[model samples]
Target: METNSMEAIVLEAPGPPEALQLRELPIPVPAPGQVLIRVKAFGLNRSELHTRLGLAEGVTFPRVPGIEATGVVAAAPAGEFAPGQQVMAMMGGMGRTFDGGYAQYTCVPAGQVIPFRSDLDWAVLGAVPETLQTAYGSLTEALDVRPGQTLLIRGGTSSVGMTAAVLAKRLGITVLATTRNEAKAAALKGIGVDHVLIDDGAVAERVREIFPDGVDNALELVGVPTLPDTLRAVRKHGVVCFSGMLSNEWIVKDFYPIGYLPRGVRLAAYGGDANDLPQAVLQEFLDAVAAGEAVVPLDRTYRLDQIAQAHADMEANRAAGKLVVLP
Candidate 1:
C-alpha cells in the first residue's frame, strides 16, 4: 500500500457479511481541529453490523465500517495532538458519515479523541471508548445510580453490561446481571456481580428474592422484548436506561404503563446525541480504565482483510468480549 493509498474494508452493497471487501483508497487528510490516526485496532459493535447490512439507514455505500478505535496519532492540528500519541475515539457519523477505522488510517475530529494511558494495550484501549462511555452515561447520568442501590443489568455478560456491572460494584451498588448462558454466570460472579439470572421467565421473582421489592435501577441492553420484563423487575421510584436493541425487534408491542409510570419510574434512552452526556462522565470512564478499576476484554483479533469473518463472528454471538480489527 502506498502512503497516499491505504487498504480498507468497503461495503459496496448491503446484505450478508461477505458484502465487505478489502480495497485500496486514497488516504484522507485531517482538517483543522482534526487528527489523522494510524489505526492499530478498532472494535466491532452491533451498530456496525446493522449499518453493513443496510439495517441502519442513512449510511452511504462503500463506507468503511468501524466506530470505536485506538491508534497512534499520525498527524494533528498544531498544538492539538502530538505525533505517536496513543488515543481513542467513538461516536456515530464517524464510521457512518466519513470513512472509519476499518482502514489503515482514519481522520477524526480532535474533540472526539481521548488520550489513553501508557499502560493500556492497544486492543483494550480500542474497546473502551464506546461501551464504557455508554454504560457510564446510563448508570450515573441517566439512572443516577448511587451507593447502596441495586441495579439489574440485562445482557449481563456483554461489554456494556459487564462495564456497568463493574462500575456499579465500584460505586457500592449491588449488581444483578442476566445472561442466557449458564456458563457465563460464574464469570459474572468473578467480575463482582452479586447475582446472575439465566434468562428465566421468572426474572422478577429472582430479583425480589435478592432485593425484596425490586432493584433500584435497570440497564436494558436487549431492548423492547426485555423492556416489559425490566419494568417488572425494578422497584418503585427506580430508573431504567435503554440503549441497545440486539433482539432485532424494532417495534415494542405495548408500553407497560402501570409497571413503569405508576411506580414512579424513569425510562431514559441515550447515545443518539453526544452532548446529551457530559464530557466529565466520559473522562471518568477513561480514568477508571487508567486506574485499573475497569478492563476492556479483547475476545478476538482479526486482520483488516478478515472483516467479513469478524462480522460473521459478531452476528453469530460467538464473541465473548470485544472483537478487534487490526490494521
Candidate 2:
C-alpha cells in the first residue's frame, strides 16, 4: 500500500476475463479542472465487458477498465471540491480514452464528478452512480415519466431495470416488469412491480392483456432485439427509452424509423454521463437509499484481485443485480 503506487486491474489487450490483470500503477495526478479520486469501490458494467471483448470502439490498451466509481476526493486541483468530499465519477473517457475506475485511484474531469454524502457502505454506494444516473436520466429525460403512468421494464432483472422499477414505484407509477427467468420473477416483485411478465421474446400481446390500451411507457434494456416488441407494448403517445444493452446487440441493421416505430409510439435513447445526474437528484437518491426508502440492486462484491472472476460472472449472467469491486 504505497502512497505513489496503487493496485489496478489493467486490460493489456481485448480477450477473456483473465485479460483484466492486477498490477501496480502510479496514482494519477489531477491537472487543473480535474479531480483525483481515491477509489473505494467501482461497479462492473457491460460497457467494460464490451471493452474487454474488443467490441467497444475507440478503446486503447494497456488500460484500466471501469466506467464508474464512488469514493472520496483526494485532490481537486481546481478547488471544485473539498478534500475528503464523497463523490461519484463516471464516463468522460473513463476506462476508454484514459485510465478509469478499475484502479485504487482515478483522475477525472471535475464536471464528471457528482458530490454526495451518505453512510451507506462503499459497495452499495459504488453500484448507484452510473446505474442510477442512467436510470433516472432515462426516466426523466428520455421517457418524461410521471405519476399514474404505467411503466413496462423489458429487462426487469438487470440492474438498471430494477433501479428504474424502484424509481418508478417511488414516483407513484404503476410498474409492470418482465423477466426471462421465472425464478427471478420474485426478485422483481420484491421491488413493488405490479405485474411480472415472462418475456419469451415478445411480450406485447401479454402487455396488452394487462393494460388493454398498452402501458404508458416502456424502458427497453435488452437492446434492439426486443425494441420492436417493446414499442408495440406501449400506448399511443407513450414513450420507450432505450437504455441498457443486456443482450449486447445494440445496433439495428437497416433501421427504418418509419417501419421500425409503431405510429405515435415515440422512441428515445439515453446514454448519459455523471453530468446528466443533477446534484440534487443524486443527493436525494442517496438520502433515500441511506434511509432505507430505496435500495441499491447490488448482487455481490469482490476485491481488486477477483476482477477476472467478477467479469466472468458478469459475462455469464450469473448475477441478478449489480456486481461491484472494492479496490
Candidate 3:
C-alpha cells in the first residue's frame, strides 16, 4: 500500500554529516508541469558536501541535498510520461532551491526528467544521471573533443574524471589522466587511461615530455588552484574546459585574461543542466553500460540512514568512484 509520507534526509543546517537527519515527511504532490518520482536511488556529489558544510551558495536551511535521482514515475499530471515509466531527474534547482532526491518521493519540473528503459540495478542507474551529463557535456559541448586527440583530465580519480576517460576512449581519443595518489594510478589504467600522470601540482612539463607540444585538450576538474598548470598542459590553439571544482577553489582573484590565459589557447567552461543532456545520449550511455561496453565506476552504495558515513567518506576522498545511495 502507498503511504502519504516518506522517509527523507533533511539538512536542517550546515554542520557535519550528522546534520543530515532522517525523518518522515509528507509525499510531495505534483503541481502543474511537475512529475512526482519514487526515488529509487541517488548519487552523492561534492556539491552536496559543500551544501552540507555551508560552502555552497544559495542553499536554504532544512532542505534535501541530492542533485540527481533515478526512479519510476509515480505521477505525472501533465501526461508527458506514463505512471510507471522509468526516468532520471537532475538539477533544475534541485537540492538547493528546493527539496531533491534524498527522499523516497520528490516532485520536480517535468522538463528536468529524462525517460529511459533499463533493467540495470538502481545503484548503477543512480550513478549515471549527473556524472554522465557533466562528462558528456564537457567533452562534446565544451571541448568538442574528436577522435585521434590527446586529452588530459585533472583529478583523474573523481567520478566525473573516470567517466570522462571511458567516454573519451570510446571515441578513440587518447586519455592522459592525473591522480595525486600514485596508488590510484592502476584504477585509472583500469579504465583505459593511455597515460597516468602523478599530480604534483605541475604535470604540464611531464605532459610535454610525452607529446613535446603538450596535449590536444585538457579538462580542469581540480579547480582554480591547478587550472594554470592545466592550461599549460594543452597545445597552442588547444582548449581547456574548466568544469569540476573538486578542490573547492573555483575563483581566480583579480583575473587578468591576457596574463592569466595562454595566447592562442582558448578557454571554455561547462556547468550544464538537464537541457544540455539529450535523452538519446543518456539512453545510449545506459545501453552501453548494460551491454558491458562501458562502466558506471560505482564505488559504494548506502541506505538513507548511512548518508552520514557516505558524506564522510566522500569528504575524506576515500572512494575511487561514484558513491550512490538507495533511498
Against the true structure, whose TM-score is highest?
3
Clashes of each: 0, 0, 0
Q: Write the per-residue lDDT of candidate 2 for residues 12-81, one digit (tens) a residue.
A: 9999998889998888888999999999999999999999999999998889998889999999988999
Q: What TM-score do all the candidates reach, one by one?
A: 0.91, 0.98, 0.98
Give lDDT tens digits, candidate 1, residues 47-66.
Answer: 88889778886788778877
Question: What overall lDDT, based on C-alpha atoms, would model 1 receive against the true structure?
Answer: 0.79
Cα deviation of 131, candidate 1, in Å: 1.0
Task: Identify the candidate with maximal lDDT.
Answer: 3
What would the TM-score be for candidate 1 when compared with the true structure? 0.91
TM-score leaderboard ranking: 3, 2, 1
Write model 3 residue lDDT over 226-325, tens digit each, in one string: 9999999899999999999988888999999999988888899999899988999999999999999999889999999999999999998888789999
RMSD to native, candidate 2: 1.1
